[model samples]
Target: MLPPVWEVVGAGQSLYEQGPVAPGTSTQVIADVPAGSYVALASCGNADSTAMWASDYPGIEEILALFPLTSFAIEQGATVITVPAETPAVPVQQSPSFGSSQSE
Candidate 1:
């Protein structure tokens, strides 16, 4: 039997698209993560395992929504983290008249 499949989504853009990952798969950050909230989805057991298994398991979309950004621990199993964008610094303006006065 295979492990399970996990997917991560950030804001409107999907960081990690739906896919099957091994049970021991290392946690990875999702793409397009905004400075705000996000979601994650996971599915256990293989689809072809059995009808009963599939029926008992929750859908990917449903599971993803169930796991909110707040619930995720910084150090834990497959989880998503929010990354803040860096702000650009403003350029300082120089006085044009100061250096030109003595030239005349």
Candidate 2:
């Protein structure tokens, strides 16, 4: 059986790693994240093994069936997003007149 492990990968590197969830239970891990894009992945087997299984088995139904029987693949998560830089807020102020005020 493959060890259950959690990993956070960013910038093509493994940022954090944790786990080996106690046999038949779940677990939670806290990781310090820096400013960057990252993908969190958790698996019960070796690297890419879960993905391979998913491909070979195919379909959610089949995957569900296989999971309870084999418990090979626990979960797969991936996402990447880009946020546009925000424009700084500029205080609006009325322009001062070049000419001096005339007496009424």
Candidate 1 residue spans exceeding 4 A from truth: 1-14, 49-80, 87-104
TM-score per candidate, chains pooled: 0.30, 0.30
Per-residue C-alpha lDDT of model 2 across residues 1-104, encoded as one tens digit per residue: 21122222224555445555466766665445555544444434535444322211223334446443444333453334233355468997765654549653
RMSD of 1: 12.8
TM-score (C-alpha) between model 2 and the true structure: 0.30
Clash count per candidate:
2, 0
